[model samples]
Target chain A: MSTILECKNLSKAYGGKTALSHVSLSLNGGHIIGLLGPNGSGKTTLIKLINGLLTPSEGSLLVGGHPVGVESKRITSYLPDQSYLNANLKIKEIISYFDDFYNDFDKARAYDMLEKLSIHPEAKLKTMSKGTKEKVQLILVMSRRAKLYILDEPIAGVDPAARDYILNTILSNYEEDATILISTHLISDIENILDEVIFIKDGQIVLNSSVDKIREENGKSVDSLFREVFKC
Target chain B: MAWNLNSDRPIFMQLIEIIQISIISGKYAPGSKLPSVRDLASEAAVNPNTMQKALAELERSGLVFSQRTSGRFITEDVAMIEDLKSTLAKEKMKQFLESMRQLGFQKEETLALMSKFLKGDHS
Candidate 1:
């Protein structure tokens, strides 16, 4: 398998606070990888660095063996933890923006998802509920045929029904050769879809392994292992 | 019913079992087209790659066959289905016998107890 994302001695700090420390990991294409960590454990920091929104303070982070820049950004479709779509823009306009920005964007697919969810193209984001807005944003992100997908806390703050919808959409839509890195602390909710998991705690990687090996050797579910490992 | 996974085992193995159950139980009828890998994955709420791996295993076992462009279909051979059904039954019966033996019941006594229960004659 081709290596999609690689990090070596990657560290990030904000003033005196260390968000990530000596994180070295490599991810290959064609798998759903879980970036598992608790709140403020540098999940967002790592994702941002990969997307070129933040620079690593200490070491190298490579996407397709290229440093974070335009090429990497072009291939990476990112869904940030917060909404980045303009509130005043109608759903169609956001679709148009993505279509213009990404050569791989499939407008029809995005519209198809919106239609399935009963979202009108003319509806403005400002008028929608938080969950609705999030769904729209997700549709936009998943519509792109990018090489890597970085979804930050996709299921957080959503009801169970909505979470199911989100997971289903992701499972059904992503490109075959693409690698999806979903960062969330909700291990149980997203555990089934993950091929491998990377457990981060206090700005460092603790465990990184395939999901099956963890289960076969440990005789425990990922959720159970996560709870035990991160017990307070 | 939608597939459910136990976290302590490899998903590929569990998926193979679930898909086999579906095939033998007639949830996917013989010769009928199977859902695309992505559709099945979404239905089972699993990754498509894992689902594909399981389906490939099923194909290798002759329980399913794939045409390059037309997608996969359940095996059309009735004998194959019957074979799988008996194999599954044998597995269940063996497990039951092992448990009964662990409880110190001889084969004859276990058979008697099972027949009594099957007859619904408990009073």
Candidate 2:
């Protein structure tokens, strides 16, 4: 399979603190990969580098064989951990904005998903509850037919039911040819669907392997192995 | 019918065994429909994706057949179910015997424990 994203010796630092340090990883098409790490482990930083939200302090990131830039952005759909939308905009307006920005954005599918979630398109972002807004954002990101979907902490801070809905939405949406990279610390919940896992710690990759191989070799659940490796 | 299973072995393999057991025990007769994916997932409290994977494995093994709109059903071949049950039982028995030997339990003592456990007497 072709490599969807490749990071070579990527590093990002803010003032004297390092967020990511010489981290090298690659994602291939048609894979749902878990980007797992504890808080302050640079999971968000790595995702930012891939999405070109932040220029790497050193090294490089390539998406779909092109360097991270305008061209790469076109093929990548990013869902940041925080809400990036303007609170004043209505849900329908948000969908229109995505439609204008992305060529592959599927407005019909977005509306379908909203209908499933019972989200009112006329409701403004400022009016919806935080969890509802998160669901809306997730629906929009997942509705895009982009080559790579970079989801940062997709299920974080949500109730268990909402988490299940978000995860199921991800599993049901997205083209078979596309790749999904989900960055989160909830390893156990998402462990089954992941084809591969990239474990990041202290701004570096400590383990990256297929889920089946990890289970076969370690004879333990990925969550258990994670605890053993990154235990405090 | 849904199978209740808890084993240290891999879940997918255990699922296969459970399906075979259901067949051998006549819980799922030939031509009978199996539980839907969603139902099975909720019953097991496992990810639907994991349940789908196990079902796909069963379909590939020719032990189950799926109709796109109608859902999956058990195969009509009883011999296949019998073969699966015998193979799995032998494997599990071998492992149990090996563990007993390693624990230094002689055959007579092992039979005695089995009898007491089966008879519900703990004296």
Best prediction by lDDT: 1
Tens digit of per-residue lDDT, candidate 1, span A106-192: 999999999999999999999998888889989999999989999998888788888889998898789999999999988888888
* Residue range B1-123, candidate 1, lDDT tens digits: 248787778888999999889888899999999999988888889888788889999999999999999999999998999999999999999999999999999999999998998999775
Predict model 1's lDDT versus the native.
Answer: 0.91
- lDDT of each residue in A72-95, candidate 2, tens digit only: 999999999998799999999999
Cand. 2 TM to true fold = 0.80
In model 1 chain A, the worst 10-residue window by lDDT is A210-219
Q: List the residue pairs that clash in candidate 1.
A: none
Q: Provide all candidates' interface root-mean-square deviations.
A: 1.2, 4.2
Misplaced by over 4 Å in model 1 are B98-106
